[model samples]
Target: MGQQVLYETPQISIRYDDYAEWLHVEWIGDQDYESVVSGATKMLEYLEQQGCRKVLNDNTLVTSMWADAAEWGGKEWFPAMRAAGCEYFAWVYSSNVYSRLSTDLTIQYTAAGIVILTFDDINIARLWLQQM
Candidate 1:
């Protein structure tokens, strides 16, 4: 499988896998609302440009709370992602309790039209995306 980096920052890295035809989004270090929104917006843009339907969202390295972005993620970003042709979203949770709570909050706010599954293991997330 070939992968290309679509976007990268200290806070996030987004890559596209040619063989799998999915986006691999890795969130790094701490997160603030601005950083989360910025990274998510970029990911959405790439999903539109690539016309990919699946995403593997990895947050295992995240260490801070970003609850502030939760509502926006569910209410705005996710809907935009869906419109951009996204079908499957596999989110790997961070070990941090706060980060996990934030992830749960975002999921709670999300609507039910798209497939969004959460996992504690990155490998499982990847496997799920592959199956999709």
Candidate 2:
């Protein structure tokens, strides 16, 4: 199957790569907490619809910290995604230290069933997901 671009704006792009068996999201510029929740929910919906259990979330392009979004993802999104059949979340760690820190904080609150891994290289992330 061809890739489906679920949502795209200046700040983010969400898609499903069938061959990879994962949802892909590349964040661009700075993102606010509100947009992250909405966009991420849509991505998760597409992920479940496509029967993909993994996500290659590339935050390397992001330039700002989103602590609120991080908290929300941990408290709400991650669990919902897990219930929807997502098992592995491969995050492409942001080059920005603060963004990675925010993600770490989010991970601390994530449900234990969700397998979250951080990677600086997207290819490594993809390989990791492929094995999942």
Candidate 3:
């Protein structure tokens, strides 16, 4: 396996594994909407440069939300991802009812080929990505 780059910010940690064809992100600390959007945008740019087509976002650690900001961020990134050739986007999350519902709704409405998965197991995430 090739080395993965881990980008650490105050609100999140992003790991990109080239050999595994996955970009794994875990939100950390307090998540402000603007910060999340900025970080995600940077991560997407990096992934595009690295030719990543799939992503696994583990938001289990995300402790806060800026709903409006999150919605805007999603709007900005979803189309950018399609342009960058992203094929799959999955979420590995605990059973947080509101978060799960919100993420599900977003995925359901997105025109991009982003798939959101709520799973308790890491292996399940890997399997989903492999099948993509």
Best first by lDDT, ranked: 1, 2, 3
List per-prediction Cα lDDT, in the order shown. Answer: 0.94, 0.86, 0.70
Worst 10 residues of 3 by lDDT: 64-73
Q: Which stretches of model 3 miss by more than 4 angstroms?
A: 94-98
Cα lDDT tens digits for candidate 2, 44-129: 77877888888889999989988888878898889889888888999998899888888898998887488899999998998899
- Provide TM-scores for the models: 0.98, 0.93, 0.81
Q: Which stretches of candidate 2 lie over 4 Å from their true place?
A: none
Query: Residue 110 in candidate 1 has what lDDT?
Result: 91
What local lDDT score does residue 34 receive in model 1, on the 0 to 100 scale? 97
lDDT string for model 1 (27-112, tens) is: 99999999999999999999998999999999999999999999999999888888889999999999999999999999999994
Evaluation by TM-score, superior candidate among 1 and 3:
1
**Candidate 3 deviates by what RMSD?**
2.3
Candidate 3 TM-score, C-alpha based: 0.81
